[model samples]
Target: MARPKVPRLSADRIADAAIELIDSGAPFGVNALARSLGVTPSSLYNHIDGRDGIIELVRGRLGRRYLPELPTGTWDEIVVETMQGMRRLYAEHPAIVPLLVGKTITDDAVIESYDVLATALVDGGFPDDEVLSVVAVLDSFALGFGLDYASPDDIWQPGTPTRSLGRLIATAERGDARSDRVFELGLELVLDALRLRLARLRDD
Candidate 1:
């Protein structure tokens, strides 16, 4: 028996299509994705559970694509590297960032990434109870930076504003440079604080 010419649907293919639609700022769903693949909405269920499944698929894709190789640097160095990769990956997929921000992530690779963070902190002398706290803080910083990177250049457009506010807006750094400088400084400050805390705890 000859198979049909249409491509067989799968989770990866659906994730790719969804990422494309998201990149183009088009609204996507079961019907839209199926249409893109030349299949009916119900056909989508055969491969993917629904929209949430596809989102997790994409999240996993990013996890694998940008997940850092294990590095031999000190814990802080490794953390900085991982966070940088994480931020850039999300920044690259700005259209999908909003959709993912509030969802509870269940992707294995994503979870593994967090595990890696916890392990690094433990190795760096973070108390077991405090390891996840540092992980949470770094994750928040990187994700927030990702969203900031996706923001429009004109974040403020006051029709009639005060001169100080106007001067501040006029002089603020724009684009990736601004985001990078802030991220670097913020990460460094965090690492420094953690280093100090660990030293104090060790002596106690």
Candidate 2:
């Protein structure tokens, strides 16, 4: 008896290869993935269903990346932490950002994360009817921030720098710190807005 020279294909391996393509902003082709794995496209079906199945694998991978546990903190604090976590996750996998937001939720890990978020909002004084909307808003913030985080430092450029533009460039030029600063500042502004909403609910 003898073993094959090439490594055997598995679902995770396929998903990993697919992720590499996406993270590099390359086109995704099942045949390409199969070739990369040194296996035939039919072999991929042995461990997973097909293209959609592989996507679910990637989704679950991300869902498992972060703990769905809502930590003990004020609603604003919880939201801030949650948004930051979401941003980091998507930023790490920039290629998947677009795919993730568009796909349906079948993976438990992702669903669990959303459930925790919903629980946080409901307990934080958000109305039941509006919880989903609030969740959607947070999603927008995290997704948008993820894209912004990957952008170049000179997002804003003027031919001749004005005083205000120079100041903007200075702040934006902090390299990695710029992303952190921008995200935190936006989170604070959003939390403040949410506070006003909560107060109005109390008033009613």
Candidate 3:
């Protein structure tokens, strides 16, 4: 009789398994991930730094997929492109978005993306002291919009006790179209403000 072949476990493999579990709406846990990969929970730690490490690996994987390109062009262009990519990635994996916030990003690939953004902002006239604040705002904006992208189309009810909200909801567009419009408009407004700030700094 032939011996059974065993598959090898690696960081990438672990990340893949985690993604599959999350995509299927299964709660992510060390034991669950190991079981999905046909291994024991202890074995996972050998390839990853336990749960937090695995989550970063998963984040890197998703980033490679949706945000593979290094953005070029003007600072606004770089910021816009990177933010759009983040939004798309988080929108696709809405469950993973919350998981990302708690962990300090250690993955080199993920960090590289941020490094690119930081470099671009400095080149675009933002002071070193303010670069991180700008980055945080961009990140927060993307995360919020991404979650919004995943939310229900009919967020507002038709008949509300408050007449004004009901009236406002009536004119709103439904579905991803609505989300897209809002994301674009919000992004434009942010960029406009940044450009204005840069101009003011130049004047000063």
TM-score of 1: 0.83
Q: The CA-based lDDT of model 1 is what?
A: 0.81
lDDT of 1 by residue, 71-145 (tens): 447888888888888888878887888777657899887888777778888988888988877888888888888
Model 3, 64-86: lDDT tens digits are: 88788889999999999999999
lDDT of each: 0.81, 0.78, 0.90
Query: Which structure among the candidates has the greatest TM-score?
Result: 3
List candidate 2 stretches off by more than 4 Å. Answer: 1-10, 68-74, 160-163, 170-172
TM-score of each: 0.83, 0.85, 0.91
Local accuracy of candidate 2 as per-residue lDDT tens digits, 120-195: 8899899999999999999999988877777876677778859787776765546567888888889988888889
What's every prediction's RMSD, in angstroms? Answer: 3.1, 3.0, 2.3
Q: Which structure is stronger by lDDT: 1 or 3?
A: 3
| Deviation of model 1 at 171, angstroms | 6.4
Q: After TM-score superposition, what is the CA distance of residue 22 in candidate 1 from its true location, in Å? A: 2.0
Model 3 — TM-score against the truth? Answer: 0.91
